[model samples]
Target: MATTTISTTNIIQMTVNDNDYNSHFEGNLLDISADPEAYYRVVLFGYITPIFFLITLAANILIVLVLSRPTMRSPTNLVLLSMAVADLLTLIFPVPWYFYMYTLGYYKFLLYPALSCNLYHVMSEILPTFFHTASIWCTLLLACQRYVYICHPTLAKVWCTNQRVTRTILAIFLLASVHQLLRIMPTIMDDNSIIMNTNNESMINNEPQKACRQVIAKWTTSIENLYFGTYFVFRIVFVHIGPCFLLVIFNVLLYNALKRAEKTRNKLLNKQQSTEQRNGSSGWNKQQQQQQQSDDHQQQRKANRGRDANSTTVMLIVVVTVFLIVEIPLAVATAIHVTENMFTVDIVSDRFLSMTIIFSNFFIIISYPLNFAIYCGMSRAFRETFQQMFLKNLFTIRLTARSSSLNPFISTATTTSTTTNTTTTTTTLSSSNTATATTLTRMKNISSASSKGHY
Candidate 1:
């Protein structure tokens, strides 16, 4: 084989052509290398994405800590905890490779030359999608769990146990992993090495040398086409479209349930008020007191249940709503990308597709961290637990340190005051004793004088 000098652009084109895959890979590469809009995307991936990743990592970690607490453990919170873990891993595994590829503008070679290309492929492509799919399924599970709890309280008891939820989460992640493997298994890393020119100055001859080797995927054409064709359709139906559709239905059902519950609660309150007013007008008696107390107790219990259901329903609604807002566009874009090749199709410009994918990905990353905010804002229990786990301990430590620092002065003042009081008390007691003794002696002397006189 002739030693062909492949530039960065040619390497990307050759890789795609070699795989014969229908992807936006070529368009994205071209956009980043030649398009004007790619500067913003570079800035976003380089600077903004890392910031979001850190925030998301920290937030999800805190969420995991809070939700995993013994007190915070519930079926719903367990789902949230699983989701946080998924989100955390989704960013963690791919970010280093992504940073190296995009931030450093080194898309041609592996960051570590010694690592196997297959492992790099999994890290760069497979794991992020796998974990993100897990997160998506977890979100769907959360919505369904809440819907069952608020809408069908009886069924929720049987269906939404902690053990059952745990099993379901495991199933979700297992299925997601299997699905990603299916997507990735058809393509293997190419065994033949391709020379990549670094375009750097040579120390000896000042000539560009083939110093780097690039890893590419080898695809059996018929198998690759059939597999991806099926995989894309499956992904569209199960991964993107199915979840979004179910979430919408669940949201609608939940919203209606919430409204009905609110109206029923209002009616109960009105009836309770009317009954109390009538009893007050009639008269106050022993029987009336007992009846009123019973009514008050019953109504209070109902009110509390209603309030809890309403708040939780509202919070889940916000969560699903945010997910839908971010996911729907990405789903549509993904569908289009699967349907049309940007290189061949003129309906959507390559630049537009590139920008769309970039923006969609950015928003998806942004969405991961927003859940922490939603939980804090809407769920009082989550907020309280978070404070107790993180903030409260920090504050307590600061207060303890302050008190410890001040303890010496405080002890000194207390000791000095105590010593003065002790000395003063002793002196007073001594003076009283002395006076009594003197008085007793004088009385004795007088008695003696009187006796002598009489004799």
Candidate 2:
């Protein structure tokens, strides 16, 4: 067997760059994740998060802009606007940093050691709790506002006016700010503090890096103890669970009120019909003279029931349902985890715990971005206005549109048709015509733009 030798030129070109690089690889390349679950988590979240962030940003912007219109200026909408603001804050403030954390901050925190103590941790600790709490409370306020509107009309007109709504929003912001400040005050220390407390203990065990590591305030341990012991439970029970229950109650009451109103309308119509029959043809003129007033009243009631009760009810219900579905899981999980951790229970596997945290985070991320879709699905005015703004090519923006028009969207023109069809002995006129007929047909998207409805 003949062994072929390499050419001198090829050998010279292939000469290895003097490399400790071979030794470096043999030592260890960085492993992003050892666990299968964590690897999957990184891939899953890292892929979809950027898309969600973009959607949330644009949707929230559109919501705010559309709600800025004069027609949308109502108490319920005001509350909804606040909720959108909170959700938008959630998406914008900490979300990008969080995405970074998911992708590389995990490793960076490990490498730098001090990165954990930086503004990133401070924000991660604060914004999620603060904005989520604010958002939940905003949702609860919207449900309550709707309850007032649907269940009590006179009181709603008086109490749930735009001024009152504005005041309530201000109050909510003040309360949320104070509550969140108090909640986060203990968890964070001033990393920017120039005066180092030599008396204070170090953040990590036998670590010299002091930059972003947790500098213990003497009270931090005590605060953490109290938080883990009592506050978390209080939060889960009263703060989280209370809102969920209240939302269901308000929505149920609104539903009942709608059913009652509908029943009342039917009873009135039946009574009117029976009275007409009893009066007979002799009394028809007098009854009809009275019928005009009755019809007017019925039409007014129908309008109120349609505009006031139905679309807004659906909107509120959807918001609350979405909130509950997305947030309740995290709330319940947090409660359980905190309780277990407080009690030093070790029944939870490490994998389970990791998955839980990831999922809870994932749920909220998925939740906040969907308000625009919900509004679009439920509110025709919103959808049409959005169409005017975004889908201008598909739908014309009417220059004459008033802010208060019921459905200023579709242009309608009835087309009359006639054609002559001749048989051997007979001539017949036959015709058929069609358009998309959006305005002439009833819109199925249960919303304010639909002109005729009762609850």
- Which regions of candidate 1 deviate over 4 angstroms? 1-38, 104-119, 191-220, 341-346, 412-455
> What is the model-wide C-alpha lDDT for candidate 1?
0.75
Clashing pairs in 1: none
lDDT of 1 at 215: 28
How does residue 287 of candidate 1 score in lDDT?
85
In lDDT terms, which candidate is top? 1
Backbone clash tally (model 2): 1
* TM-score (C-alpha) between model 2 and the true structure: 0.67
Q: lDDT (0-100) at residue 342 of candidate 2?
A: 81
TM-scores for every predicted model: 0.79, 0.67
Worst 10 residues of 1 by lDDT: 23-32
Residues 19-45 of candidate 2 have per-residue lDDT tens digits of 321211111111122333655556556
Candidate 2 C-alpha RMSD relative to the actual structure: 17.5
RMSD of each: 11.0, 17.5
Scanning candidate 2 in windows of ten residues, the lowest lDDT window is: 8-17
